[model samples]
Target: MSIVGTEAYPQDICSGGGEMKNLWASQRNNKGAASPLLHSRGGCKGKTQDCSLALSPPLGSVSLKCLPLLEARIVAWIGGPPASGKSTLALRAAQYGFLSADCEPPSSGPDWLSGFGAVGMTNRVLALANASSWLLGATTSGMVVGSCYGEWMPSSPAHIMRVLLLPEQGVYQQRHQQRGSTGWSTDGWRHAYRQYRNSLLVWQRDNGTSIIRIQDRPNETSCPDKTLFDACEGIMAHLDKTPHELCFYCRRTRPPQSAFWLRCPPECLGREGGERGGAGHASHEGASFPGASSPRADSDHSSKVATPAEMEEIKQLLLATQGGRLDRSATHNWRNPSVPGRYGYHSIQIGNVNLVGQRNPNERLNILRSFLNFTGKVVVDLGCNVGGMLHHLAEVKHAYGFEFDPRCVKAATRIAEIFHLPEHFYQANLNTFDPNSTFRGLEHAPDIVFVFNIGSWVGQWQQLYQAIANTGVPMIVLETNNDKEGAPQLRTFRDMGRKVQFISQAKDDVTGNFRRKTYLVTPA
Candidate 1:
């Protein structure tokens, strides 16, 4: 039997050598139109035009012998975990034949396609959205997108093809810590991984999609070999093929090259004038997925500098500080005089709110201008940390800051008083604040609420929906690191009957460096 997409004749069996050579030749023959999946592999070992050799394609129906790994829009829903190989597997499929679409949710906007270097909570939604969108109204022979499953956006059930990739908890953590990543220190990845796994189980029970274990494959390689054609072959296995019957193609091991660094020790940098590779690539050595990591300690003194080891320490410190409560009163210094340069330098007012310390004068001015255009007087701030945004809102709108952190509430109150803004700053989680308590005044309710990426808390969705349902105010939500967790959080919000109008979600840039993201989500 011959496959529709293949350029060659079908053989009794598909060998790695023939398939790889064919895919390699295909690279140079159709350079521009070549799949992004093939891009990484095509560049490998300088095989510019290796995939063109139409020697032979894999044979045997997916049902006849191989596992029926139907290429039906499989969304991996990859989360931040160790050794999950979400990108590795997804890229392989995309390159081979699986139409892969990478979605960075938190960074959703016109420029959402960029900023997908690391696997985080936000990437899950982005991946889901990209896969789902591709699956929407289109026929997918085989599609695999990897991100966290919880971040999935509800689309037509017919379009979804679910596949779960799980690794051993210990191995996951070991691999994560090895690469200086912060979120998945094995234990954390395991926790989140279990959550994702459980969610997948529930999802599978309701939504039927193929699930295959990497360990079960005939070849030892669970993921596709990262060569141009090898990646494409992995995709072919998923495409319109039966999951259980798809033959596990043998994957040859490539040299352990650094696409980005996981966790290389400082010693890895000290090797003299470069014995094997260039140290210039060291900066990007352990960058999360796609983001580059700067290796030079003095490369950018503007941002807080931490050595690779120091960064690991800092991450450990941050994680250690997670559940600990810091007494605000313990420190006599109420204000951090060293205000970050990232906060645009500008002074703007919205109603009684005056946002001081805006580092960027123009961005602040533009925001104030937009505030005047929409808001008459009332303004609501979601995730109003330290009431900084509220101070700005008070300049034009009757501003109120809603913060869940007690420390932030204290700081916001102080900042509001310091700025002498008439805005009301309250300590409350927007997801769960009581309507009666929050709505004490006869004062005009806010027409626009400002929220910054506070929608990702799965445990708090119900409360958030209730709050929105009760408030009935059109909100402008700004999310930090929106590129990381944008789509998953927003999808949850949308599912709750809250009409969300996307404003913009992109990196919260500071000068030339990337900071976080600002999402302007308004209730439609």
Candidate 2:
């Protein structure tokens, strides 16, 4: 049976275009272009509403009666690029009391003739169609994870909500390139998928799909495995708990309307000339729940600053660097979740991916410029995340960063290589490592040291300072979470006969007040 949704639980449907008529109804003439989106909907044309869904599987495909009512509970349909750890995330998510499955569309061989055009196509289209049916039926109960390919959307839109994983373009390319090592050709489906990838993202915006920016699985490292499985579990738990609502046709989450016998209310269904997109569709009659107000946890922000094309490019660049895994999302803010991505970065412009608030590179660079010229300086940055400050100091002859997270270091290195900058990033336990030892044989000796907003570690500052002091580097730059914390760090440098010059830094993310100050500690 075709998956269908009533306006009462519109948000339950797969993420896509504006509120529409029932899926099985006559298509609307909204002048919108037809997308190759596997999941889709249509405008209602007063079509007859059927209570029992018909799982019309392809030949030799899984049947509708096969949904494991006993085993399967609730499934979330996931959509994103390959190797995005959809299965891994789904499995981890299942730990939160859900049965999950990651589904892959069947692959097919090349149709030699189709490669002549700009957009190459696959000959194995029908197999994918059958797989799509299997995925749809699979979603009838337990959690399901799948990708966004042609003619596929969540088959159980009323129960299966869609989640789109958006990775930085660098991360996307890197992951695929990595798969190349195993001798499996990366050129086939991925190439075509990448071409239309942004379109799917665009469809996400147009229809209000949920977007999650994840980091990539990194290569084997010489250092100890420090990845915090606990933190990730928390993020996943938080995500699963937070509610999201698509503003296009939001309905309160409760008993799904699809379970209701009628599409429209019993009173409205028989009304003259009824349509799903009309006033009767957004009905608020007896739909409210006690203590529950809105479908969205909070109203997420939407930025209008960047043009669509620029936004698309930024999105591609972002996923290319950190797709399929978890990165420090905008502001380290994972408090509230939303349907359309709740981005923390400045929406109007491109900057480094920030874990906290808008730690503007220009602001940091300007603070540096006040104390010393970065031109020809050999810079060593401690606690750098993707090297935002190093990127801002473009005039520096050379830059080296020591970061705790291996993923962050790789991201920083990727940024440097992409921009053709002279920078080196090494994964280091910054808190315990001697700063001089951290850069022992690096391309350039440290002429200046930067310690940006890492006040959370109280005890390590003294050790970090002692290491830097031995390096003959007389200048140290620092930013703090607050002036109260910055005072002590600045005092320690003063006790060492270093003059502290200060500039304003990022605002307190929680309060949106009290901007942190940047300090330049120079040997006096």
Best by lDDT: 2
- Model 1, position 45, has a per-residue lDDT of 19
Residue-level lDDT of model 2, residues 119-171, one tens digit each, is: 23332222222232233333334444444442233222222344444344565
Model 2 scores what on Cα lDDT?
0.40
RMSD of 1: 21.6
Model 2 error, position 239 (Å)? 50
Candidate that would win on TM-score: 2
For all predicted structures, in order, the TM-scores are 0.31, 0.35
Give candidate 1's TM-score.
Answer: 0.31
lDDT of 1 by residue, 439-462 (tens): 444155566666544554324644
Q: Which stretches of candidate 1 lie over 4 Å from their true place?
A: 1-375, 394-397, 429-432, 435-437, 440-442, 456-458, 478-480, 496-499, 507-524
Where does the lowest 10-residue lDDT sum fall in candidate 1?
245-254
